[model samples]
Each structure stands twice: as structure tokens, then as C-alpha cells.
Target: MRKDRMILRTPLPDRLCHWAMVVCFFLVALSGLSWLFPSLNWLNGVFGTPQMARVLHPFFGIVVFAALVYLFIRFVKYNLFEKEDRIWLENVKSVTAGDHSKPLRIGKYNAGQKFMFWGIMGLICVLLISGLVIWRAYFAHLFPIPVLRVALLLHAVAGVGLMLLIIGHIYLAFWVKGSIRGMVTGYVSHAWARAHHDRWHDQISGKGADKTKPGSAR
Candidate 1:
């Protein structure tokens, strides 16, 4: 693990925000789920007491939203779709089988990662809007009961959806050998980047490889 061979993958601010948001998200999610499920009611103890959980859940949710907004601004450019993404999508089976023979021309983030990025961003925005609408201590009174009811429904749905996306994210992060290490240490081995994101590796290393022509599915 020579330091010289590692490439900066995640910056310090983004890593800090990401882990901090993970903590806040779990706390808020567990507390909210406690209310939604009779058997999971004990989860409200996440904030020490059920009453305190109710008081702090909204605040924690706001923190998660803020962290995500910061991440979105920082990473959205890298996560945008590109022509090469179609190749990656088409070779989805090969990716899952750990076969990298195809010149997928993957950049900093692959098509699957790009999809997850947008999914997380879109779901978080939904959660924020609905959370604000149903925030009992502050905004709920501003809206009619009907609107509040609808907001509560949408908030719950968005929360579960975001949690599902996050579960998939966690799974893939661990499944990819160097991904979690990159997030934690802000770096990845050159070989890992070259194997997983060849185009990005080429761009950063100035390898001068020809770009994959558009519509070249192979």
C-alpha cells in the first residue's frame, strides 16, 4: 500500500459530511420507524426517550438533508450521465460477474453509481419537502389537516424509499473492494481506479488513450 500509488478519490469535506449524514440518517430513520411499526417502537430510544425522539427527529432529518445538499453540489457533475454510460448499462451482467474485459469507458462514477446518486438526491429532496410540511412543532399548523395527512404519507414513503436506496448503496460500497476505503481515506490505489474507472484513470494520468467513439456498443 504505497502512498504514492494512491489517487485522491473523495475529498476530506465530502467524506466528513457523508459519515456525519449516515449517523444522522440512521438516528432519524429509526425514530421515525418506531412510530410506524408497533414492534419497532423501542427504536425510539435512539434519542434516549420517545418524547425526545419526537422532538429531535425533525432536526436530525434537517441535518441529513443539509449534508446531502452539500454532497449533491460537490458530486453531481461527476455523476451526470454520458454516452459511455449506455455501454455500462448494456454490460450490466458482466459488471455483476466481475468481468472487466469490455472497454466500458467508465469515468469517475459508473452508470449504476450515477443512478444511485440521482435516486438519493431525488428521494432526499422529497423527504425534505414532505418533512417540512408535516413538521408538527413548526409548519404543520400552517397547513390544513388534509394537507398534513398527505404530507405525512409522502414523507413516510420517501423515507422508506431513501432507506432502500441507501441499503443498496451500502451493499455496493462493501461489495466493491476499495470503495469504502476510498470514502474513509480519501484515496484509492491506481490499479483499483484503472480497473474500475478506466476513463477516469486515463484522464487523470494523461494516458492519451483514444476516447470511445459514440454508438460503439462493444
Candidate 2:
């Protein structure tokens, strides 16, 4: 936990954005589900009342989308697939078992993380587009009834899919011992980085051919 022994994994700004987005996403999701399921109608009170929830949900959804766009710009390079990602995929069983004996040459984000990153990005795009088409206060009036219905269906599907992916993301964060701490503090111990992201550790530590420039990963 000492500064000298820890590596910066996420910068403060990124962490702030991430947590803010989390708050907005949950509010938006809950309000969305309230309308999607009659039994959960009470959830619409998240924004004080069902009427307020209706007025704010779309705006909060936009906030989530914008935050994700910022994150995508900041981390997409690290999440892109590389030749070494194949090793992580091949040894996924070991990874799931928490075995770190083998050096998988993992980078800042592994193959599974890359897939999750892309999946989230893709789903957000779908949600945004469909949401706009079905947004009664805005663009909905421009579309035909049939088009609006299709957009509504797509919005629901994409919203549900994004929520499922986020659930999986949270589960994995908890499953990995140091993941939540890393995100919260923006730092991880050298041992943690080495064990989970060996290649990235080496780069930052000046032990690999590609030395990480100062502030590059932030």
C-alpha cells in the first residue's frame, strides 16, 4: 500500500468519472426497469416521483453514454486485442481458478476484459440510438409509429443487455481480490500487477523492451 511499492493503475480523474457514471447508470437503470415491469413501478421514485423519473431518465442515460465515451477514448488502446491476449484466452481456466503460476504475458487489460470493454461500448451505442428514436420529449415525434415501436423494443433489449454485462463486470471485479481496490485507489501493488498483468507490469517497471512513459497509462 505504500506509494513506493504501488503502481498507478487508474488516474484520479478516470476514477471520478467512473464512479459518477456508476451512480447515474443505476438511477437510469432502475427507473427504466420500473416502466418495463409493472411490479417494479415503485422504482420510478428514484428521481423523487414517477413523473420526475420520466423527465430525468433520458438525461442521466446521456450522462452515462458521455462518460463511457470518455473512458473509451482513454482506455481503448489498452483494451485492444493483441497477440498475447491469446495466451490469456487459452489459460482462462487457470485464470478462473486464481492460478497465477504461469506467465501469460497479460497486458493492462486481458482478453476477457477487452471483450467486456467492447461489449459495453457496442451496447451503449445501440441504447443511445434507440433511446433517441423513442424519446417522446425529443426525436420520437419525427419517426413513424412502427419505427418508434421497433426502437422501443431495441432500447429495452439493449438496456437489459447492458445491465447484464455490468452485473458480470461487478462480479468479476469482486472475484479478483485486488480489482476493486485498484479502481478505488487508482493503485495496485507490484505483486498484484505482476500476478495479474505481467506484461504491463514489466513495461511500467522498465523490465520490458517497451518502457511505459510517465503518465502514459493514466
| Model 2 poorest 10 in a row by lDDT | 209-218
Best by lDDT: 2
lDDT tens digits by residue: candidate 1, 1-218: 67666777787888999999999999999998999899999898999999999999999999998998899988888898999899999999999999988788998899999999999999888899999999888888999999988998999899889888889999999999999999998888888987899888877775653334211111
Residue runs of model 1 more than 4 Å from their true location after superposition: 208-218
Error of 2 at 75 (Å): 0.4
lDDT for every model?
Answer: 0.87, 0.91
**Deviation from native of the Cα of residue 92 in model 2, angstroms:** 0.7
For each of the candidates, the C-alpha root-mean-square deviation to the true structure, in angstroms, is: 4.6, 1.6
- Name the best candidate (by TM-score): 2
* Per-prediction backbone clash count: 0, 0
Candidate 2 lDDT score at position 72: 98
Candidate 2 residue pairs in backbone clash: none
